[model samples]
Target: MASAAITLAAEAPKLSSANTGFMLIASALVLIMTPGLAFFYGGMVRVKSTLNMLMMSFISMGIVTILWVLYGFSLAFGTNNSLIGWDSDWFGLRKIGLTELWPGYTIPIFVFMIFQMMFAIITPALISGALADRVKFSAWALFVALWLTVVYVPIAHWVWGADGWAFKLGVIDFAGGTAVHINAGAGALGVILVIGKRVGFKKDPMRPHSLPLVMLGAGLLWFGWFGFNAGSWLGNDDGVGALMFVNTQVATAAAMLAWLAYEKIRHGAFTTLGAASGAVAGLVAITPSGGAVSPIGAIAVGAIAGVACAAAVGLKYKFGFDDSLDVVGVHMVGGIIGSLLIGFFATGKGQSTATGVFYGDHSFTQLWKQCAGVGAVLAYSLIASAVLAFLLDKTIGMRVTEDEEISGIDQAEHAETAYDFSGAGGGVVGTAVSALAGAESKKVDA
Candidate 1:
């Protein structure tokens, strides 16, 4: 997410209690999305892989937090005029004062760092959805550490840093359309190319173990997104934050309805999975465009993203790639849809002065700028992530053994089950009892 305009120069900005309190809340909201992501992903995998899926996302929080404190913040927002940022003062978050405002914003430097850190934490976690059910937990953790350093930090600086090239070129990103969603989505595609598909790709149904959990996670994401989108403006000093807050709701609701409509027409039913996925797709789309478009424009963006992602999710089956939970389909495709549409939908009056292709005088320059931003991130993440995954796969191995996967990755990897069946009928060990109970727990992932 980009910060609100920084007008305060050498005359240091004073802290606003309201903005600080609001930002802290926003930071907390963004942090919760990781666990929300865990539940969302956890419920989508088969019974055997649920715990492993949750752990994949949860581990990112632990890994990225430490990295962010140490040097992730410095590299990502260090205010250097280059592709990467570096600040000696921000090293280990030392040499900065408690009351020191972030450049021109009224919030504390820690508040801004923590908010951005949540984005860092969640970006890598988003890739875990594609790696579900088949990866080694240790290898996956290692990839998160490496990928954050190699891919996320530089791109974050490129897009959001005050001195970064994309920011200088005037590529508009209200939140994280390019930096977070596209980065993770591309990384997901790259990693999956190396790890290959789940054990049974087209043969098994491989449905979700818990739709209720998916719905719960989706709801939590929706609630937290108000802060995620609104807080990007950095303050309620102007009504832009309020506009973003409403756009988030409007776009998400529209996307859900549009997706249900598409599902019913294409598949003849409105499934819970479609609703959950559709909501997330809208959130991804608006993340970049919300600050630049109107409420009506947000509806268009959301509806288009909903239908596009709904259609995109089915592409893996036709193309033969095993995106286990459609991370590429939803996030990658949805992010592209949102980021590019800014060229067409921007009103010239929102966050910045840039005009869209559809506005009066019809400037197509922003569209080209958006392409530059999107293409750079997509190419860098795809290549960098693929290299990282290849190194890990060749050395320590990325996937589990076929025997371990078939038996259950939970026991093979984490040594525990997501849902215990031992007490189902005096014991869930027998084939008949296990099969009956497991049958009741089954649902589809796509």
Candidate 2:
């Protein structure tokens, strides 16, 4: 009877239907963030370059998806070595069965693959904000392909892969503080250095063309982030998932308020742009710390990140580097804040048995590990991205011609415009009605 029972227990499947469903839903939610990013970046640029901005993000979704299926996933997640993963047998997911569990998880291997793919898609898109309105579409696309192969896949392996050095070194990145945000932020700075600034950067009034659109994008990004932060647990039954979900909300709200407070104190008035940027800063800061920090700790992380990123954005102007949309400020700086603070705020009971300096551990061991992860990823991404951008600039040209940039990237590159101000609706009466109604003109130089 004992032998029969043991055999039956061994025969039971490891897969859990409920967890699989949850992961499927989470993957879809995360997929929506790329389009949300398109809108977020599109509205932040001038109207004349809106389509170009949108395309820069949208194209990444397509490019990264294909790369993930072909070799990106295998290289990042497969088991080959400590620094990088070899294709082995999982190239193109070949021979991997759908029912096969992802190592120790309840979800199917395919489900895990798709979830990680969405992350790969958005990381490079984040860099488009820095090079907005100035890059050639083809060159940008090529850079995405090369950068993913060289920079992203290797960094992902180092941080998340089981045999990777960082993972073995006790570094704690619940989601992607170092792997995604810091990597992309550093890459953005590198690319902008090689590509140079926009034609009339400091001399021009480059305000956002549509604050409403930016708000809409920010809302979608916030909503999708619930899936991003919570789903990293790879299971729905874990109580930590709930904690992470709440932490995400608390931190984002706190960060938005802190940003406004800082802006009010420094600039004399709260701005819509500050609110949207603050929300994003909070999201980025809490991502890696959410599963480890308490709600109160999340507030501290968010507020610190908000103020730091807000101040960091201005440094570009002082230093003469034009990070058009402050990707370096919010993502890189926010990622560092979240990663390092975990050493001080981590509860030592959840996620991992690691406590921060503020949590009474006093050792500062975990904090040093976080610093190592952040510094390694930041340096690798910066150097690799700079090389890629320089090679592209020399061979195929990274920037648009001066005439094309000044005239408008949308028409010069894509031959399309985001808005039409031809007044084909009703001519003079429509114009007069719009004016009487206080409707802003589409032709206005936003």
Tens-digit per-residue lDDT, 1-446, candidate 2: 99999998787658999999988888888889888988999999998799999999999999999989999999999988989997656788887897988987888889999999999999999999999989999999999999999999999999999999999998889889999999999999999998898987899889999999999989989999988889999997868888899999999999999999999999999999999999999999999999999999999999999999999999999999999999999999999999999989999767777889888878789999999999999999999999999999999999998878877899999988787654436778777765743444333333
Tens-place lDDT digits, model 1, residues 1-446: 12333433335678999999999999999999989999999999888899999999999999999999999999999987769999999999989899888987899999999999999999999999998888999999999999999999999999999999999999898889999999999999999998898888999889998999999999988988888899999988978898899899999999999999999999999999999999999999999999889999999999999999999999999999999999999999989999999999998888987889888526589999999999999999999999999999999999999878877788899889876654666543566677876666463211
Instruction: Go through the candidates in order and give each one's C-alpha lDDT.
Output: 0.92, 0.91
Error of 1 at 187 (Å): 0.4
- C-alpha RMSD between model 2 and the true structure: 3.0
> Pairing residues by index, what is the TM-score of model 1?
0.94
Every model's TM-score = 0.94, 0.95
lDDT of 1 at 247: 90
Clashes of each: 3, 1
lDDT of 1 at 353: 78
Candidate 2 global lDDT: 0.91
